[model samples]
Target: MPPLNYFVVESPDPVGKDAYERIAADVLQDLDLIKVIDRLHIYVDPKIPLFVAAGLLRHMPRAIRVSDFANVNPGEKEIVLDISEEAYLAPLLRILWARFGKENVDQPDRFTVVLPAGVIGQKEIEQLVVADPSETLYKDVIYALQYIAPEGFKVRRQYIREGKFYYVASEDTLPGDIVERVVAPLFEKMGVTL
Candidate 1:
C-alpha cells in the first residue's frame, strides 16, 4: 500500500491505540482510500465515548465522459460511437439507452454503439457523463471511517469539503466545542490551518 503523507492514531491507552491503528489501516486499504487520503489523524477515547477522524484528500479525478473513452463518428443514417475503452462501455450504453430509448440504441458489439442520426448530436454524446469520481468519494470515505470507528458509536457528525474531511462519532451527543477543541487541533498538527 502507498504511504499516506501523515498517519497518526492518538489515545491514552497504548494497547488500544495500537489495535485501532491496525484496524484503521486495514479498513482504509480495504476501501481503496489510502491513495486519496494525504494526511489522517484519529483520536479515540472509549471512556469519553468519542471517535474523531480528520484528513486531507488529494486531487480527485474529473468526470469521465463519452469522448474520454470513445470516438464519435457520424454515419449515413446512424451515429457510431467507436469505443476505445471497454471499461466504461456499460455505463455509456446505459446512458445512451436512457436518453435514446432501448429500441433506438444498438450495441452491435462491445466496442460500438449506434444511435439514429438527428436524434442527438455528436457533440452532446461526447459530453455525456459516464462517471464522476467525486460522486461516490464522500460516501466511501464516510463508510471507511464508520468501520474504523468503534462499533455502536452511532451519534455522528461529519463534514467534507474541497479537500478536507472530518468525522466524529459517539454514543452521546457531541459537545458544541468539539470542532474547535478537537478536530481543528488535529488539522493544525497536519499543518492545515482549518
Candidate 2:
C-alpha cells in the first residue's frame, strides 16, 4: 500500500477518525487534489457547534496548454489534434470553440479535434491555455470543506494564503479572532500530530 497522507480529525470521538479519513481521501482524490495537500487538520466540537479545517496546500497547478496533453498539426486547411490525455479535454474543447467559433471547431471522436485554418495558427494553438486549475481548485476546496464540516454550522470564514488554506464555521457569529484562536493553533500543529 502507498504511504498514508497527513490527515487528522480532532474530536472527542476518535472512533470516527477512520471514517473521516476515508471520506476526505475519496473526495480529494476525485478532485485531483489529494497529492497537493501537504497536511489536513480538522476539529469539531459539538458542544460549541463549531467545525474547523486547516490544510497546507503545495504549490498550485500551473496553467495547462493543449500541447501539454495533445499532438497538434497544422494542415493546408485545418488543424488536427490527437489527444492522449483527457483530463483537460473539456476545457480544451471550450477554449477551442470560443476562439474559433463553434462551427469551426469539430470533434469527430473522443481523442481528436479539428479546426479550420486561420482559426488559430499552429504556434498559437500550442500555447493556447486550456485551463487554470488553481483558480477552480480554490472553489473546489471551499465546496469540499463545506461538506466535511459539520452540518448546521453554516456561518463560515475562510483564509487562503500562498500555500495554505483554513476554514472555520459555527452556528453562531464568529468573532474576528476566530482564526487566531482556532485555525492558527491547528496550522501550528500541522505536518506533525500532537
Candidate 3:
C-alpha cells in the first residue's frame, strides 16, 4: 500500500446526503479499487463557501489496475483498444502516440483507438501522470475529474500545503465536525458500515 494523501473539494451549494453519495460513487468510479481503508474521512462545510470537502484518500489505486477502462488486446501486428470512457483517454492516447508514429495510430471514435505493435509493452506506459509536461492531456483529465461531481459544486481553492490539504468552496465557513456528521450516514447507506 502507498502512503495516504488528502483531498479537499468545495461546492457552491449546500451538499445534501444524496449529493454526498453521488460524489462517493464518482470517486469510486474514477478510482476503482477493491477496498479502501476505513481511515477515509470527508468534511462538508455548507456555510460560507456553500460546500467544502476534505479527507484523507488512502492507498490511491492505479488507473490501469482499476477496470476495463483501457482494454489492451494483442492483434496480429498491433494492439487494439476499446476505450469506453473519455475521462482518462487523452493521456492514454498521448502516451501511445508518443511511442508509435502518428500514422500507426487510429482513432475510430472518441473512446476507441488502435496502436502499433512496437508500442504495446516495449515502452513505459504511465497509467497516471501526476503532472504533465505537455499540459493539455494532463490538465484536461484533471478538469474532467473535477466536473464528475454535481453542477452546483464550484471549486474555490484547493491547496496541498505542508502535509495537510485544505479546500474552501464558497465564501462561508462551518465547523469541521458538521461536515463529518453529514457524510457519516451516507457512508453507512453505501454499505460502508464504518
* lDDT of the candidates, in the order given: 0.90, 0.81, 0.46
TM-score: model 3 vs. ground truth: 0.37
RMSD of each: 1.5, 3.4, 10.3
TM-scores of all candidate predictions against the true structure: 0.93, 0.81, 0.37
- TM-score between candidate 1 and the true structure: 0.93
Candidate 2 differs from the real structure by a C-alpha RMSD in angstroms, to one decimal, of 3.4
Candidate 1, clashing residue pairs? none
Per-residue CA lDDT of model 1 for 1-194, tens digit only, reads 34998999999899999999999889988989998899999999999989999999987778999899999999889999899999988877777777878999988988888899899888988898899878799899989999999888999999989999999999999999999999999999999977
**Which is the winner by TM-score between candidate 2 and candidate 3?**
2
> What tens digits encode model 3's per-residue C-alpha lDDT throughout 4-122?
33223334445555476466546644654214322233444454424433333233344352133656665778767777656767666676567676788899878667777765462
Which candidate comes out best when scored by lDDT? 1
TM-score sort, best first? 1, 2, 3
Model 1: residues >4 Å from true position, as ranges?
A: none
Give candidate 1's error at residue 28 in angstroms.
1.1
The digit string of per-residue lDDT tens for model 2 on 120-144 reads 7788889988888889888888888
